[model samples]
Target: MAPGQKLYPRATVRKVVKAHSGCNVSKNVDVMIFLDYMLFMQDLMKEATIEAKQGGERGVTARSINKVTKKTLSKFKG
Candidate 1:
C-alpha cells in the first residue's frame, strides 16, 4: 500500500458505519462498501485537483470547453 492506501481496520470500519447512519444487521458490510467508495472518490478528487492545476497553467480556455468541443468533433465523425 502507498501513503494513504490501507485497508480499514475494525475501528475505522465502525466509524465509517456510524458516519453513514448504518443499521445493526449490515452496518459493517455497509461500512466496507462505503470505505471502498470513499477511497475511489478520494482518488478522483486528487486527479481532478492535479488536472485543474495543470489546466490553470495552460490558460485561455477551460477543460470543460475543450472536452465538449472534442466530443462534438468526434460525434461529427460518425
Candidate 2:
C-alpha cells in the first residue's frame, strides 16, 4: 500500500457508520476509524509473519493467517 492511500474512502466510511448507527459521524470519527482498522490490520499481519516464520515458511501464508486469526481477534475484541 502507498503512503496516504486509503482502503476505504472517508465519505463511504462515514455513510456506512451513519447507516448503522443512524447518527452522523464527524471528520474525527472518520480519521479514528481509519487509524484503528489500519493499526489492527498491521498487527494482524505482524502476527501472521511470526506464525509463518515459526512454521518455517518464507512469508505470510494463508495457513499462517488462519492459525493466528483466532488469537489475534481475541486480542482486539471490542
Candidate 3:
C-alpha cells in the first residue's frame, strides 16, 4: 500500500483473484502477480483515456489496448 492509495479488503482481493483464476482461490503469488498486472493496465487505460480526450494520436493505441484487455478479462470472468 502506498501513500494516498486505497487499501482493498483482503476478501475483495481474494475474490478478484478467484474470479481471474476461475478457481475457488488462487495461490498467493498468483494473486499478487495478477494484481500488479491489473494496476499497470489501469494506469495505461487512464493515460490513454486522458490522451484520447485531449485529441492525441496515442488515443488509437489506447483503444487497441482496451480491446485486448477486454478480451483477456472476459476469459478470466467468474
Candidate 4:
C-alpha cells in the first residue's frame, strides 16, 4: 500500500486471478512475468519502509507468488 492507494477489491482481484489461472504463456514469459512481479513487490516493500520512516502511512499489497510455483510444478508434472 502507499499514499492515496486503495487495496484491490477481493472480488476484483479474484476475477483477475481466475482468468490467469490457466494462462498458457511461454516459459520465458512466465519467468519474466514472475520476476517482474517479485521485483515490483520488492520495490513496493522498500518504498513502504521508506514511507514509514518518513512518518507517512505504509501498507502491504497482496500478490500472487504461487502462480509461478504452479508453473514450475506443471513443468515437472508432465
lDDT digits (tens) for residues 5-39 of candidate 4: 98646555445545777654443454455576776
Predicted candidate 2 versus true structure: per-residue lDDT over 13-49, tens digit per residue? 7888889989878877788876888988998999999
Task: Please give the lDDT score at residue 39 for candidate 4.
Answer: 67
Best candidate, TM-score-wise? 2
Q: What 10-residue stretch in candidate 3 is worst by lDDT?
A: 69-78
Clashing pairs in 1: none
Q: Against the unseen true structure, what C-alpha lDDT does each candidate score?
A: 0.56, 0.87, 0.64, 0.50
- Candidate 3 lDDT: 0.64
TM-score, structure 4 vs. true: 0.38
Q: Show where candidate 4 strays beyond 4 Å.
A: 1-27, 56-78
Clashing pairs in 4: 1-59
TM-score of 2: 0.69
In model 3, the Cα lDDT at residue 78 comes to 44
**What is the C-alpha local distance difference test score of candidate 1?**
0.56
List residue ranges in candidate 2 displaced over 4 A: 1-12, 22-24
- Estimated TM-score per prediction? 0.38, 0.69, 0.38, 0.38
lDDT of 1 by residue, 1-78 (tens): 789887758666666666776655454675656776676555544555566666674432356344444444443342
Model 2 poorest ten-residue lDDT run: 5-14
- Tell me the RMSD of model 3 versus the true structure: 6.7
